[model samples]
Target: MPLCHLLQFVTSVVSCSPAELKLDNNGKKEKVKGFNVILKDTILFPEGGGQPDDHGTIEDLPVVRVLRQGAEAVHFISSALEEGREVQLKVDWERRFDHMQQHSGQHLITALADKMFGYKTTSWELGRQRSSIELDTASVKPGEMEALEDAVNNRIRDHVPVNVRLLSIDDPDVEKVRSRGLPDDHAGPIRIIDIEGIDTNMCCGTHVSNLSHLQVIKILGTEKGKKNKTNLIFIAGNRVLKYAEKSYNTEKLLTSLLKTGPDEHVDAVDKLQKTVKRLQKSNLTILRDMAVLIAQNFKSQPARGDFFSLHNKDGDNEFMNIIANEIGFQDTIIFLTVGEEKGAGLFLLAGPENVITELGPRVVELLQGKGAGKNGRFQGKANSLAKRAEVEALLQKHSCRRAAGEE
Candidate 1:
């Protein structure tokens, strides 16, 4: 037998202290209006099994929250209550009731899927907004999924009583309990949740007393996973109503924006994507034509090797590089403008390799730019056109000195 089964057997027979219900006044004790009780024992498993803790009033002192520290259960309370004082604890019935409904509903669905289709629930996550369960199955056909949903809902409508029992591990029917998995060291008597003639599993989480509490169970979607695994997203009870409301509003907004019905939104978006692509292509063609015209105008100007200019409205960096390569100069000074505005500029000042080696840093400092090359190329943004001229004059003066062989 498993260690947990042995532990469960021992735990069942042993009469331990009634699970200590901590008052939620930050561990501080205070006076209470009406609170008294000596519980023989409790089945409320303080928050565990991916489910949140139970909330309610203990001895009329509102239990804001219940948390487990090690093996002891601590209840966080708003009102101060004396410690060691007996209190009649009352769980938040609505919340606890809802959880019970959802949990039992989950069991019915998982059991039906396993019995009918041989799918096993491998993992599950109960989140605040939604919940999901991963099943160890390759795929679930649409018809099968619909059938499973209908079957689970039918069980809920049947209003089956959900029975909670403490049973010894050595009990004759222990092996008959068809649970997906049980705790490794489960000892003493295990807490078993059984739905008459439908499902039975060992679980420590609180559950609804009856199936009727679970009003509905709706499968939202499914995603394929590794090997033979698939995740199913679902909502239960009031969550189903909330999801429907949100989805309806979203689709209504999309229909208005696309000037089409909710069903036509996808087609509207596809058409919009094609329109954007066509506009981008047309814009590119216009930019290419403008670049050609600018290059022709620059070629008309006389080149003294002192200054080279090309005005571009599109701020095309590729065009600047093309013009620079064509107008080669031993001592070149290139000044390209981004249209008539003060945008970006590139300056290339190169003398013979030998000349630049000595005065490269000095030229960079004078132009308020920084770069390194054996020849010379300095590219950066300029504040204004006047600053460009000052840089050009400085480069021109330096080039003249080099031409005269005066270092």
Candidate 2:
């Protein structure tokens, strides 16, 4: 059987050397001047038991991954160590401790969730930023969530011992364990993690010696997961502090933008949205009336067989449609109306068939934009509004040439 690389059994000094590494895609050992080394044993836990492998350095080369194959633990590396030579191994203590705290906290939370609400954890993922466990239920109510959190935190604050006991399959203690069950293949020894006066469960993942190391457990939220399960997202230890800091910074930014304290931000945003909606309605009324006046002005002017233009920053497709339809209803005059609102530019042209045919492509080409229309009307979006002035100038010049030709 492969030796379990437990932190409790190994020290910083090891007699291991470059043991074995996986090959690259080309069916040969990578020549990238790196060693695939494993210790005679390791303090770094191989990825298993729903927890990730421990990250650290062996003989000064960074360990990429510690994977288990059959009965042996394999540690992939960035570079190789001398074969059969002694080396130093260092586990990233901060990372290890963080995993320990999270794994232990999960055990406590999972136990209490079952005991109090009968919600069994179906599965769990140990993530770097946040960890999550899927509970075997379709829905998790807010009150149930609060109760679970309170119960879990109550255990953590109690500073109870989290002891590990190794036992055979036939051990009486195995029956006492609150376990999902043993694997179908069956194993040699089962490592049972027992939380004092709480629960005992079979787990291979590392854990804190005590619950106080958990520091704190925060249930971020939950979502419906696969097969009608509820995925509970959580963070523990320093991660909770980091998450709190990020949330605080985001709220502070919202406070600045809304000009309100965090407590009043919702009300302020609601009022701001209502105010904006009213202003938009008022602006649309003014622009529609202006479009009417402009159409009348162009109608009152002497017929100029050239394209005229109107610009409105606040105009929309509907407003442009009203303006274009209003003026061209009476004369053979071709006009260009443009608006650049919210950094998007739009244009419309209508008039004599020849003018629309000639000017449409010229306008689109000038802006390097996209447009398509037929029967004396064409419009399209520009790549950007920055080139609107250049496109409009080209329209003016084209219209002048067409007028000259007509003369």
Q: Using lDDT as the measure, which candidate wins?
A: 2
**Residue-level error in angstroms, candidate 1, position 162:** 1.6
Stretches of candidate 1 exceeding 4 Å from the true structure: 1-47, 52-70, 74-98, 184-188, 280-407
Q: List TM-scores for all candidates, in order.
A: 0.58, 0.66
Per-residue lDDT tens digits of candidate 1, residues 371-405? Answer: 56654443444434435555556656776775677
Please give the RMSD of candidate 2 to the true structure.
Answer: 7.3
Report the alpha-carbon TM-score of model 2 versus the true structure: 0.66
lDDT by residue (115-205, candidate 2, tens digit) is 8889898788899799999999999776888888887888888899888889988888788787776656454688988899998889888
Error of 2 at 221 (Å): 4.3
- Indicate the residue-level lDDT of 35 in model 1: 25
Q: How accurate is candidate 2 locally (lDDT)?
A: 0.75
Off by over 4 Å in 2: 1-95, 126-129, 165-192, 221-227, 246-263, 287-313, 327-383, 389-407
